[model samples]
Every structure is written in structure tokens, then in C-alpha cells.
Target: MQSDPAAMPAPAGPRENRAVLVDVALALVIGWILGAAAQVAHWSGQLAPGRRHGPGPTGNEAGHDWPRWAEGMGQPPPGVPWPALIAAVVILLAVALRRAYPRAAFAGALVGAIGYVAAGAPFPVTLIPLALCGYAVAGREPLLRWLPIGVLVLPLAVAGWWQEAAVGLTEPGPYGVLLITAAVLASATMLALLRRARRDAHDRERREELRQAALGERLRVAREVHDIVGHSLSVISLQAGVALRVLERRPDEAAAALRAIRGSSTSALTELRQTIAAFRDDPGRGPTAPPPGLDRVDELAAALRAAGREVTVERWPDPLGPLPASIELAAFRIVQESLTNVVRHTDRAGAAVLLRRTGDELLVEVADDGPPLAAEPTPGGGLHGMRERAEGAGGTFAARRGERGGWVVSARLPIGEAP
Candidate 1:
């Protein structure tokens, strides 16, 4: 079964969801390990929840006497309490959104950082959320998200510096550094995935367009095949049947009918070959010379005139001058096909052909005194073929009923005025 074009797969779906889930789990694991390590290492000096020491330092306040958990300078210096728990949660959130809702995870990390700072979390623990937010937001969201991230950075950095000051130089603990690395990696990975998605979308669009064009071309070829074979065979069949039925009575008419059958069969064979050849090789690259051009306008007009119809021809001096072969061929085909349609469909036997150069444009117009076919509302393939020729040559073609009940086919080809 052919798939509906509208139901094609979108760029985001099940795979993306799975990736997000994995990222979240990984983040949670990382956060848990970090929190547990800090707690067990005495990083926050085991301050029991809601327990207050007797006498505090000079600047330390009564209720805000720097909880042991929140006492670290910048990072949550390897210790566990309420702060460690929150930071770990933030990490898990960041991981969850790494693939899917990156922006949400990014914002959540920043919020988690603030929560950790206010709750007197370890200095190292706070930095984790800050790094996560900065890395996440900068890559995906607008730069405005950076403002809040920037606000979080100041406190986190200060705390880190304070801790470094408290502990002597060369305190190479993996606190701020690890968070920065993780954030950078996350941002890069996110950007890479985004780029891949865009490229995939672009490829899909291109393929769809080509597929549509190819289908249209196939339909056109089918119609042409019908016109060539069906029309020819129908004419031959009718003539042969007439000839067979009237052979004993109307000898002369039967002979004429037999000749017409022979003629139609020959023409059909030729047309069939041409149609099959077109399938194997594009005419543009074939040995066949391009179609007729503006020079043939008078001949086309004369042919119509000879058939008991009046034809008038107007030409701009050298409008057919050394033009690109493609343009010349296109203009010729447009006028030829238009004239052929007039011959086959219109009641009027004659038409006028006009070709003029207006500045940088060439205009070809074929107008007939024939009324539009009210019953056959759909435009025929001949007219469509002419329009395609004009458009393929970087021009515009229009065919409409004229004010005087006649029909007009006009095509404008923008030119560069041949040197």
C-alpha cells in the first residue's frame, strides 16, 4: 500500500523519548553518587537537622547561623544534608531533558542551584546545578535565559573561591571542574543532535518534492501514450470497419477508407516508437534537434489560413535572433502547441500569432476568434504541455477566454537582449 504523504514520520518521536529517559537516569545516578560521597567524607561537618550550637561566631546570626550543610564557601565541599539531596535532584532533572526537554532541565537546574544556596548546601554541590544550567540554556534557548544563569554563577563562583581560600592552595578536588565538563559535553551533544535533525528534515522535504514531480511526469506520459495510441487506433479501427462493411456496394469509398486505415497505422507506429524512446532517453540530451522557434510563426499562420480560416502574423524584427537554444525551442513549442489546440478544439479555423520584444522580455501570444468550450471545462494536455514549456524556460504562460468570446494563449519570456 502506498503511504500517505501527509502521514510521513516527524523528526521527533519515540527515539527521542527514550534518549531523554536515559539521560535523566544517568543524571540521577551521578547526582546520587556525588551527594553520597560528600556526606560520607565529612564535607559539611554533620550538623543534625534543626539543632543549634550554644555560642556562635561574631557575624553569625541566631536563626541563620550558617547551617553545617550550607557552610561551604562556593561548592558543597563533599558533604550530605538537605543541600546535597536537592543538588542531586537537579542533576537528575538535567539528564532527563538532555535529549527531549533540554530547556526545562536547564531552567530547573538553575532553580535547584538557588534552592541549594538558600538551604546552606555544600559549595561543590551548588556548582553542579550552575554548570548544568549554563551549559544547557546557552545551546538551546535564547540568550535571555543566560541572565538568570549568570546570576546563579556569581554566588557559585564566590562560594568556590571561599572554599579554596579556607583550604590552602592546590586543593584539586573534582567539584566545579566536573560540572563544567558535564555541561559543555551536554551542550555539544544537544547541538549536534539538533543539527542532525535539521539536515534530516531538509532531506525529507527534497525527496518529497522530487517524488511529486516524478509522479506528475508519469501521469503526463501516460496521457500522451493514450493520445498517441488510443486516438490512432480508434481512427484506424473505424475506417477499417467501414471499409469491410461497404466493400461490395461502395467500392470507391471503401478503397478510400482502407487507405486512411493504412495511413493511421503507420502514424501510430511512429508515435509509439517516439513515446517509447522518450522513456529511455531525455530529449534534451538526445540527437533530435530542438523544436521549432519564432521563425516558424508565419508557416504556422499560413497553414491555419489555408484551412479556410483567416490568420494574421505579427513579428518583432529579429525576435528570433540568436537566442539560447532552450529559449528558442520553448517559445516555438508554446506557440505550436497553442495553435494545435486551436485546430483540434476551436470552431474558428484561423488565429493570429504575435511575437514582440519589450525591453528585456519576449512575448509570444496566440489568439483565436474561437469561443471557449463550455462543455469541456478542464484544460487539455496540449495546453498544459505548452504552459510547462514556457515555465521550464523561466517564463510565465497564461491562457484564458478573451473579452470578445475568443481564446488567448500568451507567454512572456524574460530575456537579456542577445549580443
Candidate 2:
């Protein structure tokens, strides 16, 4: 079975859905409690006394306790306990839903207000929920669409002036209109701010991802550097030692070690150039000329002799034939680096290098009879360099403690003509 290219994961919508649900449930519970409290208060008639004899208007509803302040007039008293309770509950539900789920919350507020009207709440009072719904809806929609919703309520506003749809309905005059208008404007502003906040969060996440990618690139560069330089210097050190020792006893042998050192140094310089080229981005920069092949092992051995390490090279004059550039470089570096390690780390008087070419491949071995040295850390800078050179050329690299306390570095590379 194959994987579908279109499959992907998304999370934001679900999280927002859950948040809205929790808010609505909380609003519902609170609205119920407030309504019940308002009913009990109204039942006591503690709001105002019965109509008694005389003055301007006895039992004037204007003297009763109003639930909310609007325009210039107070809304009618909540009336009897049950009616008052029901009205209180409606207002609570509207206010709660409007603020909580500003967009989706509008539905609940609208429903609650209509219920209050059915229960005989006054017109000016009923306007409370309508105003809240207006503000909330206006805030949730884009700027251009919000004003039309305000225009929708004009007919209902005009109807309040004539008579009580029930006993409590009344015109709230200029104050009511002004108050509701203010709420609509405020809601629109809040929505703009919420939109801005979301954009800022998205930008922050993008920057963090870029920072992590840069860090990874730097680490890869460091590893490649360690692989190239470490092994080359070790080989140079061993050859230098051989050259120095032979200088006193055999001028010819000393000269050999010096030659080997020079050869190895040249190889190191070439590898460094290739590494730098790998990192350059200019399209003009192409892969460099192929690296040295293993056929040059004799020259490598002579370099060690010049460095003062006793060196012996045994091989078919051209044991390793033509090989791929990558494989050739790998084999050369492996041999070069191993000899370098022997010169640098061993006090051995002499070292032996062997190259055996077989069908489609070549095996290289470097062993020394130098003074014993303790084991060092795995893939230390030098060994790591040798390993990379080998593996990169489609080969393997291994270095370990030898039987006589000396160390050996060996590599096997694929066969092909040298680049």
C-alpha cells in the first residue's frame, strides 16, 4: 500500500470549538440562578406599596425598583415573583452569552430576550438583551457587515412607542438609542484587536522553526570538518618521526621519510580544498577535480620515511588498479590517515603497510611495530576523518589495538579506475 499525498493534520478548529462549548454551559447555569433570585424579591412587593388614595398617580409603576439603567427613564418593575424571575433569567443568559462566545453567543442572547418579552417584561427592559445581541454580532462580523444588523432593529424600536405589547412595554426615548449604539461600536473594536493578536502568534511560530533549521546546518558542518583534518595530521606525524630517526643511521632512509611527509601534506591540502568547495553555494562552483587514488601508496609511504618513522611498503607495483574517484580518495585517505596515526601516536621503530587488490575491490592494511600505546576514544577526530573518507567512497574503515600493542587502521574501497 502507498501513502496518500493529500493526508495532513490540522488542530485549531477543534480547540476553538471546545472553548466555545464550555463558555455556553457556564452561562446557562448562572442565568438560571439569577432569575430565581429576582423572582423571590418581586414576590415580597417590597418593591412598592399598594395604590392608596390620593396624589398624582397612586401605585405609579415608576416608583418601583428598576433592574437596569438606560436612556433617561427607568424600566418598569419586574412585576410578580414568577414573571420577575423569568425576566431576570433571560437578561442574565443574554449578557453571559454575548460576552463569552462573541460570535456564536449571539443566538443564545437573542433567544433569551424574546423569552423575556413573552413573559411580559417592559419594552425598555426588553431592549437590554437586544442591545447586547447587537453589540456581540457586530463585533464578530467584519467591519463592513456589522452595521446592517443594527439597521435591522429599527422596526422593533418604533413599535415600542404605541402600547405595551404587555403592560410593561414603553418607549425609552433618546437615552436608550444612544446606549445601544455605544455597545455596537465597542464590540466592533474588540473583534479587530482579537484578529491582530492571532496574526502575531502565527508569525512567532514561523521564526522559531527557522532558528531550529539553522542550528542543524551548523552541526553537520562541524562533523565534516572533524573527519577530514584529524586523520591526515596523524599520518604526517608518524612519517616525520621515521625520517628523523633515519637521519642519523641511513641518509637514504631519512630522505624517504621526508618525501613521505611531503606527499601526505600535499594530500591533506587537496582534501581541505574539496571540503571548502562542498560548502560554497555559487552555481559557478562545481565539484573539484577528483581526489588522489590508492595507486599512489608508494609515494605516501615515502612521505612517512621522510618524517623519521621506519617504513616498509609491500604491494604489487600497481596492486590497486583504477577505481572510482570517490572510492580511490577513500582508500588513499584511509591508508594515509592510518600511517599518520602510527607516526604521531606510536614510539615504534618501523611500520608495515599492505595493499591487496582483488576483483572489483581493494583491501588496505597499515600495522606498526612501534612502542605500545593505550587505547584512545572511539572515532577521535583523526579516526573519524579516516572513516568518513572511506565510507563516503563506498567503503568501510576500522581501527583497533593490534596484537603487539601497536594500532592498525584499515579500509576497503570499491573498485574502479582512479578519477
Residue-by-residue lDDT tens digits, candidate 2, 1-419 = 88766785455487767755764665566555545444433432222112112234322243334332222444434545565456556556656666455544444444444444334333344444555555566545655655444443443333323233332234354235435535554564566547656766777888888888787566546655554566557666665666677798888877877777676678778877877777678798766765466667777676555554578877754544456776665666666667666655656556788887777677888888865656643677767767766776677878777789677778877776555
lDDT of each: 0.61, 0.58
- Name the best candidate (by lDDT): 1
Off by over 4 Å in 2: 1-228, 231-267, 285-287, 314-317, 372-379, 387-397, 413-419
Candidate 1 residue lDDT tens string, 1-419: 99987898677678877766766676777677656744643443432222223446433333244534455464555523666576557766665565456567665665565444334444445444445545555555555644444444434433333433442124443344335645654565467457666877999999999999999888667755654565455445555666787899989878888777676678668756765675665656566433345676665555444333577878786545666666776776676666666656665446788888777788989888776545333567766777777787789988887666568889998776553
The estimated TM-scores of all candidates read 0.41, 0.41
123: Cα error in model 2, Å: 28
Error of 1 at 247 (Å): 12
